[model samples]
Target chain A: MTINASKDLYAAVPDEQGRFGPYGGKFVSETLMAALAELEVVYSNLSTDKHFQQELDHDLQHYVGRPSPLYEAKRWSDSIGGARIYLKREDLNHTGAHKVNNTVGQALLAKHMGKKRVIAETGAGQHGVATATIAARLGLDCVVFMGETDIQRQALNVYRMKLLGAEVVSVTSGSRTLKDAMNEAMRDWVTNVDNTFYIIGTVAGPHPYPMLVRDFQCVIGREARAQSLAQTGRLPDALVACVGGGSNAIGLFHPFLHDESVAMYGVEAGGHGISTNQHAAPLTAGTPGVLHGNRTYLMQDSDGQIMDTHSISAGLDYPGVGPEHSWLKDIGRVNYVVANDDEALRAFHKLTKIEGIMPALETSHALAYAETLAATMTPEQTIIVNLSGRGDKDILTVAEIDGIVV
Target chain B: MSRIAGRFQQLAAQRRTALIPYIVAGDPSQDATVPLMHRMVESGADIIELGVPFSDPMSEGPVIQQAHERALANGMCLSRVLELVQEFRKSDDTTPLLLMGYANPVMYMGYKAFADAASAAGLDALITVDIPPEEVDDINAQLQRVDMDNIFLVAPTTPEERISRIAAGASGFIYYVSLKGVTGAGHLDMEEVTQRLAAIRRHSQLPLAVGFGIKDADSARAVAAVADGVVVGSALVNAMAQTLADGGNSGQAIEAVASLLGEIRQGIDSAAS
Candidate 1:
């Protein structure tokens, strides 16, 4: 599937009937149907409002420390002997990940709604931590629901949330992972419909969340565009990022979707390999279905039961990608590919040694593609990668795999 | 021997409290659920709230969520749970059985089909956690057509207008979530819940069941003192978890919890008397 880069694509969204390429539409109970209709109207008005945009811009500049750097990885680029490699450094952002950017914007929206409490769910716990941080900053009562397994594995994050004055509830249902946490979060949203705001952690869930989270996260691409232009005097030949629920990738890709000259690639983590059960490469291997909220590509068995996904990075071990990504994949604005565990691990070590940066195990998928992109093109062409997050939290898992103490 | 409302009315006229125990049918396994429910009825449970397994139950705590997940994993369909209710009806038709679950499964099964199935299965009523009375359509209409009650929730924050609207739709009873948060959160405030109940009763004459944080016998008895019924879930589900941790299956766990409910019933009975 290939999209005509010259075609006006933004109009394709919210089409004649407010549908997103058969992926997104309002499919909620009629009780809150009017509320959603009102929300849609408010969202359209607010999205285009100059004051709202100005307030958001002000926060992004001073509060979030935006326009993050674009670093040229000369050593890594030379090692691959191909394209000139540069990284859009989102890892250097406040809260140590790109998640905080979305959280800050959504929390403000919650405040605008007069919502008193914020509820969220997390998988790798990065989003949970970011949501908690913002909720604490905003002085809103925060409740985070995480899978019990994730709570145990990401113990430091759980403690961080507690320190931030958020109540952490461990979800022990379903597969005891991200999906279960999402289900539990939806339940909380339904139960506390009046005063609570569900701060969805990713570019998933029903309409508005995916679109709204993407809009908030567009800072990544907006920054990368200016930085690349200033540093290289032109746009890069290609853009690359890892997709786990696609928040980071969408953050970087939303601005560049119409760039005719630049190609885009999203690498999915294929644990062991896609042939085996231990992989999270949903775009490469899944069928279209509904879960969480909207219809999207999901890794499921023949019976439509979602499969248990496995990855060295807990963040990438999701059975589905964001619905917009599914639409984008179908339309082919971005090429979706897989990077298996071994290649990602090798890239992780390579980045640490050659670039003085240890990429998150999830981000290693993008780094793995860096080698491929660099090797395939001449040094004249440049590839800008979104370094979505730091690897500090993933050190233990990486070290355990390497049989090392540090 | 009698209609569920008649039985509840009789108990209400006698100024006695009703013992309601909840069990997630097909939890742990299907083979154990029906027998355990019967055992619960025999062990002094006056009314039973049978949990129909759902994929997502956000209002539930970890314990109840786990039980529901386990049941759903074991292939517990809404039809299968209704069949379990039918099996229970073969022996004891007097005990009121309310089917409690999230709305998706019931909606997917088609409201008319679900109501017909529930009626055929001899189930008394429904308490869909996510379905508000204002949104009641196919399911409520079908249930009413079949003469089965549709229970609605009156939360602590329910506005008076909404309360009256919910009262109009409510038939068998009203489930008033005692806490502002989800189930199994913390302690409940009796004063707040009693006030809410009074507000609800001013609009309608339906029985009210207070739940969400009724943990022990004292809490249940305290709620029963004012509310028409008490729905206990999280604590019983926690007991199931505890029993499983102690190497007992759900059948044995439910029986163990049923004995605890028996003791709680005694407390309620003595307190009411």
Candidate 2:
């Protein structure tokens, strides 16, 4: 199905109120409104400023290793015997994940805004490490809020954040997970709004944040778009990416939103299965409500209380998704599918043995869906899967799941 | 006039600062809340802010956050909170009652349905922590239809222009968050509260109620001196939590909360005297 070409989807989104068709809006406490407004003004001005663009590009090139390669998985595609599959290797970035692409941009904005302190909330710790890396480089004081549960699971990244000079605060409230950490981070920001710059990790949060983070992460799609045309002489037939808070997915999807011919698929974590309550696939199994400062598809109970989600990958365990994805799903601009834990694990093992690449468990969800999609298409069709992160941080999780002492 | 506006006007005529005491509806237990509400009104609470327990209370400090946890653990929900309001109105319908909470539960109930149900249950006003003036138009319209007041918070960080915008749409009164942090945070900053309230007064005729950091009689008196009302939340919640933590029964918890409200009332009255 082709979207109308005359609509100009990019030019009109998150309209003045930061709403993406009633999904995204500023749903924060009154304390953060001015800060969000200040951020919106600075980002709007600096986003188009030539010097700011040049500086951000410089950092993306040298510091974050931009233009992460899009490699064609010839063997894997041949084995599928359907479509040619290419991998957008965001796993090869400086932090071994696509998270750095946004952190660098936001850290620069913090410096330009003259803020001296930076704070963030992380679940799997990839975003935390990335923010810590940038804060260390900029000599800014950094504090990262991670749930006590995630701190235990992602110990290596937690230590890495500490080594990078970020004080890791362990949040122990409300299921001890990403959402709780975010609440703590918000409280901290409200308390110290004058000197603190909150670096939201994904395409979520209040206004300007969803838009700002998307702009920064769009580097992935921009690079993949150019590389696809240069190498294959056409845009890929399909794009696939895992959706947690949907930063990487939106990054890869936004640039192609205006490309009517390109199909997009966002894979959500179907923990046990979407049929069961034990899943984080909000777009698949949940209703629309407000959480974490935006109105989006959320895994909430009948009482509107957020449900505890169970995803094998800590990164994909959030009960809510980015509001833009909610909008896209409603408008039929994107197809949202789910990959259960077993399916994702099988894809993880398959990619490790067949492609000689270890993909993060979170990324494996997208790969699982891509594999299924590629098998249904003709060989002339091409698919690009966003390899959002490397699997090194998740080795221990896989080991524990297999009952192996790693 | 709405019950909230009437109560504020009554307090103003008497040259008294309204004492608004807040408690989660099902904090100690579901049965304990109605009695606590009656006790608070009898103890000179001009308004009662009953908290609706949500899974995530992002704008709350540790004390109130734990209270929400306890309330939810006891099976509290939006429907249950409304039921409690109905029960509170059984005998004492004069005291203004407000439901303070995050927006998700009410949104889940549907805006029109929630507004109608709340108005039917005798709720005077609402303070959704996350819904500022920008995103409040839809809910505000529903509230206006029901002749209910929609209160907005004017925080320490709220700019002058936004204050004007918020005050223009706000009904009942303006909630001046006395500090930049969440509920239950310390450091009242009396000077900042006094200044922000002054700035807010320039925009609208809404009465100003100062909350956050007002933990005791002295702090309540300090805020009452500069604002039309004093909202004490965490201190009362902490008293109830401590009572329950010490193995006290529901009656003891109610007594503990009412005692704190009585002292805050005394403080406010002392300031007026």
Candidate 3:
């Protein structure tokens, strides 16, 4: 589906108040307002500073492995018999995921702000590992909050964070998942606002966070736009990425948002199914509400109590999506769909065996939807799927599912 | 004047600081809230800040967070909290009651609808912690339409410019979070609070009520010396939790909480003298 590019969609968004058309705003306690304002000002200045840009670009290229390849999955595409599938290889980046891109940027911002400590909330622990990696490099103290359930599921990443000299706090409150860890992180930031900077993992949270994280992660789309033209002679027909707070998806979609000919899809984790009401597809099955400092699509009851979400992939098991995705959904600019646990597992194994590439279960959700979408298009059409992370961290989860002790 | 403003005026006239006590509705049990409110008022609570239970109360420490969990387990909700207000009003309409919680519940019930329903239920003010000054305009407008006051929090980290802005927009009284952490998580730094309260006073003439870490009678007395009102939350909730854990019935729990409030009230009165 083509959009009308006559209007400049990018220039009008997240107005001065940080609102994405009534979706995104600083819906946090008074204690956080000043810090958010300070961040907004500092980011606006440093985002354009020549020296800061050079430093960030240098770090991206040398440290985090920027310009990850756009490899065409010919065998997988031929086996499926449809659109030519190309994977934006973010899994090849340092720390093995797209998460490092934003972390590297935010860690630099933290250093520039003269903060001595940094804190982050993680689900699936990929973000925690990435944050720890950068903080170790920068010689800043790091604390990562992970839910107890996630700590058990992603032990490897937790140990990796510890080995990197970061403290991992186990959050045992409300649902024992991503949302609770975020709550703990917010509390910590509120308390330590003076000496610590919070490095949020997704395109969510209050103002400047969604904007800054998106800006940092947009490298994915920028590189993909250029790579598609250079390799395939033109931009791909479609872009696909999974939406857990929608960082990876937005990173791959934002640069192409105004490209009228490019269709974009954000896949949400469907734990059981929408019918069973046990999924985390807020954009697909939830309503607009405030949570974790922003107004966004949330999985909540009628009484406004946030509901517990379920997903095989810990990364996608959140009750709310980023507010920008809420805006994108409202404007019909992106199609938000769902892939269930079983389907994601199928895609996880399919890519691992068929292409010798093991995709993170979170990324497998996107691959699941991509397979269905690819089956409908002609071979001439090309689809770019964001391989968000490597599946190495998910080995334990997969093994446990198969009832194996290992 | 609204009930909240009138009460503050009366307290100022008597040179007595207002004693505000916060409790989660239906914490011990759904049937226990209205009685607790009445008991608190009798025990010398000038204003009642009833917590509307939310699944995620991020601003609360573990003490109040557990209270919210217990309340939710007892099936408390926004509508029920309003119903409790109406129930409390049935016996005594003089003591001002305010709903204190997060913003999502109010957002769930449309702003106008919530304002109308809450005002009709005899609520005097609203304190949704997560809705800061920048985002309170629309909801504040709705509350104004219903003649209800939209209260705001002034934190220790709040700058003077933002404080003035918040003071300009806020009605009723301004709530001063005395520490840099979540509710019930920090020790009261009396000097810092006094300094911040003095700073906030320069920006607004409205009465300032201080909360967060005003736990026992001693802490309440210390804060009362510098502010127009002293608000206690986790201590009262903890008292009730202890009563329930010790196998005390809801009545005993109410008695325990009321006893603590009475001591706090005495502390405030003693500070005034």
Candidate 4:
């Protein structure tokens, strides 16, 4: 059973303390309590404050170029020959991804809160670049915590962030990946709470974070809804987006939660396969536990220590999904699925060749699933896939696999 | 009176500040834990803050983090930590022992079960690093039933209004992290510590045990002059680690740890005296 369509998504969730059923809670250090408490107040006041909304609207229109097009993938749709496919091209955003949406909102929030610096944790580097872009625009000091592994793999994005004038800290702890970077970022936030604002890149972390990030990114779903209705004369039959800490997916699916006729899909990274114990699909195969500030689905061993997750896409390498996603999954509001590394690679090639859009490896997971789902539906049906980011940063990664010199 | 209260009373009567040494439960070796604890007491440690190793410790810096990795590498679990406490309790019941770590392991054992087991093991107090006052009152209620004190940490970032609320659920003592950074960090601001502890004193009468950033005997003495207790973690843990690469025996490791504790103990006593 998915979340009830009758209940308002905003009214039903995260109460005052940032909880979604039993999922989201302030599972953070005592040092961060005051900062989070103050943030809650600031976010609440500014969310309704007309001036803040105007500034955000101005940035969305002119700065990041919002209202990203709903493009019909005619060639790609015809090849599948089942459903008409449309793409909400988030890849066209300022940082070439949907990640900039949340960053812009949080950077604005930081400005409102009187914080002079912003810090973020990133895995795939899209969120880092996004945060760096906003911090540069707002003239706030920026620091991005990236795992040692990710810094090595995503060197181009690292250079881009540095070129944007953001200091990048390499996290060397715990498997040296996204989760470790998250821990380091939290440590930095806890230590530097007075003058710095931690802009979490995902729709996860502690309470207000899941709610706030979802609220900010919901701009995606809001625009897509109006555009889809205008262009297609009705709502799309299905909505699909890849889940990695689930910001982009939740951004697309949240507004459509009340749409009973629309089927929602959240595609997660399946590194090799689920049975191989090398994937990051926590909602699909994980137990509920606390990590990175919220209690949600996690990939952990029996003794409760978090397990290392494997995924070709660094963005989806985390072992936990957003708590709201976990809640929605439990309530059956969203169908959580997976696209393996091979399938995602195939979709990357297919989308690039067919649609002339080189999608991020993270977004390729959505494209992979949408292809299969489209094959099952009749041509009368319609599907909207959130092409979360452009794949330029992943060119070297893809080229390495193809054994070609770039 | 509780063991923690009695110790504080005894220390107050002696006009001396308490010296609390912290260690990861099974760091050097599981079998060596009880002996190292006993050795610490002999070296003038007034209390023990035994770490229950967690996979993720968000607030801890590199030193304690590495200590946890070594302990978990030896397959140390929460039950093993309780067993060590029980073993330590068999020989010594007077010294108060506080189990310090994050909340996940305790959450894994149910609150009631964890409280019961800890009380049975003679753990006098517990400090869950992640829990704040609002989220922990329920667990504190259960812990209180077992006569176990839930010690809360009042960090430098902790707001003044929140301190009284944090102190309300507090027992044993309130740990005041001396710096804004994590465990093992240097840069102890003696003036800042004096000012913050004075502010904390206005909100809390709970004996304040200052920790974090107290690296040496001099810093411990400086902090002890202001607060009721001084906790030295990373420096002592770092001492034990300095010998690990050379394949040093537990005896050598314990000697290094106890030696540092002795100096800090002397530092506090000399300051108070």
How does each model score on lDDT?
A: 0.80, 0.93, 0.94, 0.91
lDDT of 1 by residue, A22-141 (tens): 675443322333344445566677889888788878877787788678999999999888999999888887777888888988887887788989999898888998999889888999
Candidate with better lDDT, 2 vs 3: 3
Residue lDDT tens for model 2, A28-74: 99999999999999999999999999999999999988889999998
| Tens-digit lDDT track of model 3 for A241-315 | 999899999999999988889999999999999899999999999999999989999999999999999999999
Which residue segments of model 4 deviate by more than 4 Å? A1-3
Runs off by more than 4 Å, candidate 3: A1-4
Error of 1 at A115 (Å): 7.9
Residue B58 of model 3 has an lDDT of 87
Model 3: colliding residue pairs? none
i-RMS for every candidate (Å) is 5.4, 0.6, 0.6, 1.3
Clashing residue pairs, candidate 2? none
Supply fnat for every model shown: 0.18, 0.91, 0.83, 0.53
Cα deviation of A179 in candidate 4 (Å)? 0.7
- Cα error, residue A202 of model 3, in Å, equals 0.2
Which of candidates 3 and 4 reaches a greater DockQ? 3
lDDT of 4 by residue, A1-406 (tens): 4346785664689877677888888988777888888889898899999999999999999999998999999999999999999999999999999999999999999998889999999999999999999999999999999999999989999999999999999998887889999989998887888999999999999878999999999999999999999998999999999998999999999898888899999999999999999999999999888888898998987667788999999999998999999888888878999999999999999999988999999999999999999999999999999999999999999999999998
lDDT of 4: 0.91
Per-chain TM-score of candidate 4, chain B: 0.98
- Candidate 3 residue A360 Cα shift, in angstroms, is 0.3
Write model 2 residue lDDT over B12-110, tens digit each, in one string.
999999999999999888988898899998888999999999999999999999999989999999998999999989999799999999999999999
